[model samples]
Target: MGRTFIAQRGQTKSTNDRQFRRDRQTPEVRYSIENAVEIFIHAKEAEGLRKSTIKGYHDTVRYFRDWLSHDIGYIDEITSTLIRNYINYLKNDRLPYQGDEQREKTKKGLSVFTINIRLRNLKAIFRFLVDEGIINKNPTGNIPLVKDDEHEEVQGLADAEIDMILGSYDDKQFAQWRDKTLVLLLLDTGLRINEAMSLTVDNVGFQQNTLIVPSEIAKNRKHREIPISREISKRLRQLVDETEQYFGEGSRIFMNAYGDDFTADAFRKRLNRLKKKLDIPKLHPHMLRHTFARNYILNGGDVFTLQKILDHADIQTTRKYIQMDSEHLRQQHNKFSPVRRLFNRKGKRL
Candidate 1:
């Protein structure tokens, strides 16, 4: 199963070859970035990475393939200079991965965070190629990552803010009913926006007080039931009852104004309108998810349970949802400080 790969520039066969078994016997395997990507992506699928993760690989590597002229350049043609050139392209040429009309950065090129995402993804693909003996060196070597500013983004809304948003919606109105249910479902269950929107009427178990997130729609590609609040369960049943009256019993739980199932883009636009109407500076499904995690931890739920509730593939991902800024820390201290618990007067013990 050995093949002769082209050598790196100015290097001998024995110099950087990890998989070269050819001593003038095996046929040389011509390797291009395009070929490597196709090979590697299949390997990724075989390795059981999530579909979304594989999609990210495809998205990021397409930029690399484009830069290298997929048909002409072999993997050995990748040099540090080519990688640097692509990094500059990401910074100066590509549109931001996620942006709004409000963000000025979207008008031109990507933000540092978005560029770093592509670079990190490139580094991963290069590492894979090197391990498989397709490339001798990782051209993405030692390139600095753009400093990401995710910490500065507000992680979760204040409890009072969440209350204000939820309470402002009047469920008698059809639009309010849908938005309120969407917000409450996200807050109570920690479901991702897509997962919640993809739910069919049968996916909800009114008697069991749970929502089934199917593996096909879940980010992790696994089926799990998210327990709903009694209030949410009641609201969900009511929505289903109303929708069933028109679309018959088995329609999607959340739908558009016209009572059709939601597409991802439609759901997002709906959330955008909800955010503006609520007067919340920022409101999105993930923020409600973070709010769920924060409140879960604050109210004595453990990280392991939070991990399962959030449907995170890793506990580390769940950990990011717990926001403990100075003000929050101070508030927690006022409630649970051991010194305050034991002392009655000044420094005197109770």
Candidate 2:
């Protein structure tokens, strides 16, 4: 049976007859604990989160639910102290997948980014609880989120690195064709991994040379079209032909050789394998999307265009991609630097 939240009841004691017999109710049926998680999951789906994102939300909250059920009891008892303790538990605990060698290895905790994800999910859950009248106020309202220093360093990928990653893909290998296509789609369209994978044959307009990604498929459930580059178009046509040949007409543009839909875990594994072979660290699918925006901005693309391409709901959200490279910074310094061309190698005065 699927997990259900039963309101828990605390143990009770009652005095009986002249013998003074005490009646005790078992602790199991205390209060009717409404699994606050159901509300959170339903809310995200109602808002049209992508299938992958919905799954992610479900997983995060499911773990949280389990923790609350077993390690801690009573939803009302969830407090800031409990949340902090839960964070520490997640940080210190060894994952089930840890091998013998890794078992003894002093593994580090979740990165600030990952920690923030758990925090965000919990916060969303509490917000939903409040909206549903499960709780009068959010306990996580004032809790400070873990600050991520890595985000400052990982502004975006560099232009040269982008070229290297794309160039690393072997065009002639059929086995890696779909894999390469995934990278191409992310780089060219700036689509999230889930959005790119959800695309069916008809979603692409060969005549218009555009791909129509609908709202429900996107991260934020916003529809947008991204133009395909000439090179990407050629590869997509080949991939489309192969997909039709293998899976019949109107099939997905990319699929596993076994004709199954690509899973998120599989994609992560693929990228990790490729990263190991290429000697790169943290080569994630999002990095390709970031690479796209970074290179686009480097080559004269502006925030407006980037926002549309990246499908960001706000222009400010897109502005983060406008990070200038070292060369751009140097050029700006040479053009309008306060020091006026420091040494004046060309004898051009300010």
Candidate 3:
């Protein structure tokens, strides 16, 4: 669908008539950002995003729809001022998509981190529109991302807190084994909830003690083999045997009470409830993933190796979780006393 505009001709009656006649046939409408968004959705689906990620983009687009209803539908109408207002709206107003705060009766206000994630997706949407010639330029190009401090504390379960949560689980409940195993698997392997839930019994190799994730199941649709520790292997073997007794071949290894694969939301809710019950704060799935990365890097794991293990598309993304190692910090502190080094300095005599 192309839009045409009649160019004004100064003191030219004949040219005006010709342009007006041409304009009548072609509808004078701006590019629809809404339609561009739909195209973006189709494009993302074609890229083969996991079902959960596609659902998230769908929800983000749904919110964008609400945002459009308040703003205008045309891509050309998306001025910088409008984007500023939308950013402020997300920061101040409670979003419809976020879950209700457990403490408060009202919906939880959006966090800076959460806002940036949606904004990043929004950036991708407009960038795609511009590249596809759906729009002449991206309106979001000039919009600044919400900045955040690099040293900001990540929310996750500490070692002690994880122990407490694990301690609180009932060993007798079949669900407990499933849930606990899932958490441990995430911490051990850094697998996303969807990836972990997609695992089948055949993915595990008892002899080699390795978990081979196929390309189709991975987030980036790339396969890699991850080593499994004896502890994780033992737990998985028990869980697999029990699960197989009830479920036949080709069925998912993990299942909820309803015999369905665990959705990410359901897993989160269960984890949050466990945290509340255990009086452990800020426990989540990605937290376990974070804990895995942090500990792995601190314990001398290589960055390049970590990137492959985490299945990060870029090495820079892997670097975020790699903080200064404790040993490195200690060595730096020891080297800070230059006076002691000078006094006892063993260098070649000048």
Candidate 4:
């Protein structure tokens, strides 16, 4: 006789019951992790995220998948515990893959700021999944960002340093004059390097003495007009005329020797060359921006206005520049102290 299969507790001798046992033995596959990542990327692209932002999301997920060794195929296999372990891995085991130099320098792992960026990207992916009803719970929900040094003094170039950089360029050479004009514009308006490079002749309002940073090129994707000084306006007009005469009427204000758009990387490399030539090791593009912010705050410009000028979405970011103007703060305190004023009025020596 054939061996008998007896039903245990909560079991029945029916065809449906037998099928249920089989189902328990082999769980259903909902979605693979790769498929989920693809879906998330498509959704983000549909939502009008920038290509760079989408690339960040894809890269973060790709790194996470690589860490899993490709064994954990299903999205359901991911858990809070696994994510915590991954965080630990980032803290202890992960090494920077930038280059041999970076790998040797950061053998301890990535910096807290970089790790936080990856964490944020991963969190965004899982949050999207939960919001779309693809996942019931977010694995990264309970995770918190690693703390960074917020009070570290902001580095802005000194007046002498700025003078040195500005004086180093020659006005006679086409490239040199263009670079000098670029530096002056950066200092005057505090525009990000990319935004400044994207400017065209029409973007400048010569009569209004303002620069119109359009929504397409603005970092925050919001349009705003920045008031430019008469000096800067003149310099910009000269650049436009020079560019037009040389390149035969191009829209872009800044162009490479080949009459192509000047890229941020090219600007960075130029700064690197200047840094070596001037022996100002800290000379870089963003330093010019920081110098602008510091000077703006010192010259009695309010943080609220600075926020708009710099296109900072948060007032808190603009407020940091206020802290950087400690010398200015001291001068204001010395000039306006009520006790000092009262003593002066009374002719008291103290």
In terms of lDDT, the best-performing candidate is 4
> What does candidate 3 score in Cα RMSD to the true structure?
6.9
| lDDT order of candidates, top first | 4, 1, 3, 2
Residue-level lDDT tens digits of model 2 in 312-350:
888877877666668767876677775665655587655
Off by over 4 Å in 3: 1-33, 46-54, 69-71, 95-109, 150-156, 298-300, 323-350
Model 1 Cα displacement at 114 (Å)? 2.2
Estimate the TM-score for candidate 2. Answer: 0.74
Position 189, candidate 1: lDDT: 85
> Of 1 and 2, which scores higher on TM-score?
1
Q: After superposition, how far is residue 193 of candidate 1 from its true place, in Å?
A: 1.4
Listed per candidate, the RMSD to the true structure in angstroms reads 6.8, 10.2, 6.9, 6.9
Model 4 residue 162 CA deviation (Å) reads 0.4
Q: Which stretches of candidate 1 lie over 4 Å from their true place?
A: 1-32, 42-51, 65-72, 92-109, 130-137, 141-150, 325-327, 342-350
- What's the C-alpha lDDT at position 96 in model 1? 56
Which of candidates 3 and 4 is the stronger one according to TM-score?
Answer: 4
